[model samples]
Target: MSFEFVGKFLPYFNDGLIITLMISACVVLIGTLLGTLIALAKLSKIHVLRWLANIYIEIFRGTPMLVQIMIGFQLLGKIPLPEFQLGILTEDLSRLVPGIIVLSMNSGAYVAEIVRGGINAVPKGQTEAAYSLGIRPTATMFKVILPQAIRNILPALGNEFVTIIKDSSLLATIGVMELYNGAQTTSSTTYQSLSPWLLVAVYYFVVTFITSRLINLLEKKLGKGYTK
Candidate 1:
């Protein structure tokens, strides 16, 4: 409601926005990579690998992210890490590192399921054909199966990216200075609680909305060749 107040703190929000995007980008890349490996492990013939992957996925997916962030912060904070600056962002590796790690781990669990489902959706004959040509199982999975599986799961992966953007707010609890923390700081300083939050909500909506539209466009472009 207070446009003037919101305008005054826009730069602070922008800074927080940068951190949020950075965290989400790291989580998406790391989570997807970790998830894909977990998915492959889950689909492996090795019983020990399947069991370990199942346990990892279950533990991360079953727990709350906030708790994970808090615990990870405490545990990882013990390790000594040097702080550095990245332009507008001051890298507090103690908090930022744990926040990104916990988020990536949590995200990896859900992405693992998405990837597993995508792999399952692929036709079995594809693998059979690859194997018939004397392709090793690993080669068949990497070369023949994962590409198709990734295509099938693009929308789901996009959703995961959006989710990470929103969920990055949790990092604020441990003082990582993300968007929500910026709002909180503004509210504490300006003595207007609702306006800062409202403005932050708009910021979140704009980012997520634009991201969703971009993902949709990418999906369409990717699907064009398959369309009749």
Candidate 2:
């Protein structure tokens, strides 16, 4: 409610926002790459691969992300990793690395399903046509199938990115200093609980809203040349 209060802490929030974006970006990159591989594994002819992928998807999807982050923090702490600075972010690799890994694994489970559904939605005839043209299965999947599947899943991927932006807040529990953590810091410093949280809520809404609109535009552009 106090514009002055909000203005005073804007820099703190901005710093947190930068960390939030960094975490989200890293998670999206790792998750999408991991998820694509999992999706392919799930669709593979090898039962062992499919089974392992299913188990992975199930375990991650079935658990709370908060729990996963906690577990990751504990487990990854045992590994001795060299710490380094990355711009404005923390130099402590322990929290940062584990938080990103946990979130990426969690995101990958959901993204795998999204990608699998998208791939499944593609007409079976496309694969058959590729096969008839003497294209190998790998070529058909990578060259023909995945391109169409990615187009179909673009909107869903956009939603996932937005989800990551919001979900990155969970890293605050591990002291990664993202938006939610920023809100906590501001709240404690200003001794105004409601306003700090409210500001971050507004920040989240703005970021997610703009992201969604950009995704909608992208979907429209991509949908232009293709039918269905």
Candidate 3:
């Protein structure tokens, strides 16, 4: 394997890689926050809220993320959405925003289910005890139920984050041009015997491995107090 192309291709993708990392981070953070909300809604005592959350989970999880990205950024932008005029977002936000939105929407579905499972795994007595102690329903959820639920679901959440990291490659299809895009461009320009592709693969592997390790630590910490 000729290693000379490393110097040639790496610089070209350096900026793009930064953008990719930024995009992935945004997707994870935004997705997790939104997902937690949806999860709570799905587990709500109100049937209406549960139904709404279920439908949302079904639609996003059932749809292809690629289709979502294309429709969200290109088609929807052309059609002019009318709900909110949040003013123009930034250059980075343009491609990255839609990508993040689509991914967060998609990931939220699975996350909701994971969170629900975590909630179920929590001892039912805990909720009852919170109620007996005069904790409001909302307070019980935020302070007692959800916190424990989140601890249980940390592993699943990490797995989803890893999935999102890999799935971020889909953004390139819409011209977001992330790490994979940078690799493609470099490979085409240099005709560089697969080195660029290999490098991109290595980068993903390392990042994912580190993420998995961190998640492992979280799971261990949670496991100390919980069963799953």
Q: Please, what are the lDDT tens digits per residue for candidate 1 over residues 39-149? A: 989988999999999999999988899999999999997778777664444657788899999999999999999999999999999999999999999899899998888
lDDT score, candidate 3: 0.79
Question: For model 3, how does the per-residue alpha-carbon lDDT over 1-228 read when each residue is reduced to its tens digit?
Answer: 566777766754666666667777888888888888898898888999999999999988888888888888874445433332112211344555677788888887888888889888989899999999999989998899888888778888899999988999898887665778878887777787578888888888888999899889877876785553
Which candidate comes out best when scored by lDDT?
1
State which candidate, 1 or 2, has the greater TM-score: 1
Report the lDDT tens digits of candidate 2 across residue range 86-189.
44445366788999999999999999999999999999999999999999999999999999998889989999999999998888887776788878987888
- What TM-score would every model get versus the actual structure? 0.94, 0.93, 0.87
Consecutive 10-residue window with the lowest summed lDDT within model 2? 83-92
Clashes per model (N, Cα, C within 3 A): 0, 0, 0
RMSD in order of candidates: 1.7, 1.8, 4.8
Once fitted onto the true fold, the runs of candidate 3 whose alpha carbons sit more than 4 angstroms away are: 76-92, 225-228
Q: Please tell me which model should have the higher lDDT, number 1 or number 2.
A: 1
> Which candidate order results from sorting by lDDT in descending order?
1, 2, 3
Which residue pairs clash within candidate 2? Answer: none
TM-score of decoy 3: 0.87
